[model samples]
Target: MNERPSRHVIRPSGCPGLLRVVQALDGGICRIKLDGGSIQADQAEAVALVAERFAGGVIEATNRANLQVRGIGPERDALIESLLAAGLGPRNPAGDDVRNLMLSPSAGIDRRMLIDTRPLAEQILTTLQTHERFHELSAKFAVQLDGAEALAMLEHHHDLWLSALVRDGEPWLAFGFAGVPLDEPAGRVPLAQGHALVVAVLELFLDLARPDQNRMRELLAEFSADEFVTLLARRVPLQPCPDWRRVASTDGLHIGIHPQHDDGVFVGAVVPLGRLDAAMLRGAARLAREKGDGSLRFTPWQSLLLPNVRADNAAGVLARLQALGLLVSGDQPLAQLIACTGSSGCAKAMADTKADAHQLAERLHRRGQALNIHLSGCPRSCAAAHIAPATLLAVAPGRYDLYFRDATLPGFGALQAHNLTIEALDHWLDAHPRSPLDA
Candidate 1:
């Protein structure tokens, strides 16, 4: 195991990293960023072990496809060291916080992928970590590389987004700034120049953005996209792509058996409320070793996928995942519900959102309704990246204000009701089965 480095070497940030454990209402939070959302089985076991030994055994699969161990005690160094030994730490300690890149969980394996994005993703990730200039980026500054996978998370916005495209029978990447792949792209680059395009964009952002402008959107607010693209053209070759728009990804593929590009299949299951116990993770790792490839991939939807399982063993894998306490079917109400760490773990939270979500899930299940609902403890809406069809924002313990997503509105969208109890909210939802809120 590598020796623990001095505390000064770690960056000062409110966010948690492997080398920097930030204090929380529950305990310390140490986030382990995975490469392209992939982790080997042995590394996962190491996470489970240290979580059980040094923390409360409460592990979270974050919305960004990373794992964080919560409720950690003072043995923070030991936990971090163990994870580093398992190969979870960044290439250098200084690079940890800047390593924010999102790729489709099925990057290489997705059957509908236009190109395998793993290789380019690796190149981009390494540059993000090792390039000292890139380290100046805010911890939240992120990039997304999409292989045009059918299982992609296309809704989450990023500082920069690149999606695979084919023109004239040759693969190219269509990229945009401060938006999702679904947005119209700024330009296209040859597949071989994808890495250069990413580098050029980041360097230009650093050169142009003010100290206060930590995100691309913030910078773009001051400078127009067209103007920025015009400037970017001087750094790298750019091609017009006015006609390109990313296709929307299919949903529910993250919670069931799905075929990969090869003959094998991948099984996916949701971690309940985005929280998992050590046993659950260990069990999943064991399944990955026995029935699938010796690796697991996490998705932005807070789910885990075990890829390369034999087609015949897919059913057994799903059954075992269900036994491990993961929601295996999208129809399960818990699978559709997401909740943030509420009063139990976040000082900013007004109520125990996780507990309330469980109650809400049971009520929805009893009504045979599996609606996409987000239970946020506060306005930050940390539980969801995209607005859900329905949302319940906590106002007090056991009380919430309901909102239905409206493209015409902002925040959690139009608030439909205020300060209703869980039971009352349940009845309200049932009463509006035919409403657009239920769509």
Candidate 2:
């Protein structure tokens, strides 16, 4: 940990953190950010213990590859202290909210990855926390580092994204602002200058943006991205990324057995509807310690991967995960469903989305149809950072409006029905069986 130290100044944010517990309908919630989504077995165990002891034992796997403990009670200070003792806190209090860097769950081990990404990610993360200027970034402002992994989450939006690529046998990083790596890169830089590029981009953003423009997208709405890039070029050398587009890889690799770059395999399982009780998390941690590399990597897909597991033990690991109430296969109905902290937790929720998601899962299970679905308690869509193939937006306690993802449409996409019950939605799915909702 050869990182520079920064001053501690608590920034005000509505988002929950290990130190800042935001109150919900259920109780208080504290988010514990993981460095590139990687957590050790002992750290996982410690989180489980604190959740059970100080909170309500309800642990949520966030869409950003982080974890949050819900229903935290009066022992909030104790919970925070316990987590800080486990080395889960940021280097300084001001660094906590700005440490929002995302990497593929299979970052270092993905067989298809062009670069390992861990080393650069380490440097970037250290700077994000230790550099005081970056502390002014909005809690939601994020950055993504792509190693061209086959199992990457390419759809999620980030303020800045850097992806690995090669040009004439030399490695370079294709970068973009206010969008994902899947979009055409704004520019490119030598691999060695990636860190410098990020610093320059952030500093330039801070210099040009007004106080109200906390996000890159917000600032870009008023200022041209081209102009911003021009200013950034003065700080860091850049090159044009001509006619380069990231290749879309296969999906659903976040579940079940997947081979790593090494001979070992990674066992992945979805935390059913993004909710994990203490027992479930502890069980997964125990399995990681016993059968894997004594570590677990949480994915942006609301799933966890036990990396470096022996290929021979893949089946056993999958079975054990299933026994722990995790959805181990892509075909599992629960695996395809994601719900926000609905009425049962969040005060802003219009319906109990988690409970309804279970009902929808039961209906789909009977029909043997598995589709990627998202149930949001409101339009805020806290559960899904990106648009899902199908979305059930709650209008009332048990009624919802359904939307299918359409590339041409915005928001939730094309609305198909309004104020339909779960049963009615099931029947509608049966009617339009060939809809793009399967995506």
| Top candidate, metric lDDT | 1
lDDT by residue (tens digit), candidate 1, 35-138: 99999999999999999999999999999999999999988888888898899999977899989999999999899999999999899999999999999999
Error of 2 at 289 (Å): 1.0
TM-scores of the candidates are: 0.98, 0.97
* lDDT by residue for model 2 (1-439), tens: 1111232345567888777888888988899999999999999999999999989999999999999999888887788888988999998787899999999999999999999999999999999989999988899999999999899998999999999998889889999988898898989998899999999999898899899998999999989988988888899988898899998866989998989998899999999999999999999999999999899999999999999999999999999999999998888888999999899998889999999999999998998888788999999999999998889999999999999888898899999999999999888877886777643
Q: Each candidate's lDDT (Cα)? A: 0.92, 0.90
For model 1, the superposed segments whose C-alpha errors exceed 4 Å read 1-8
Give model 1's TM-score versus the native structure. 0.98
Query: What is the alpha-carbon lDDT for the whole of candidate 2?
Result: 0.90
176 Cα displacement, candidate 2 (Å): 0.2
What number of clashing residue pairs does each candidate have, in the order they appear? Answer: 0, 0
Candidate 1, residue 32: the lDDT equals: 96
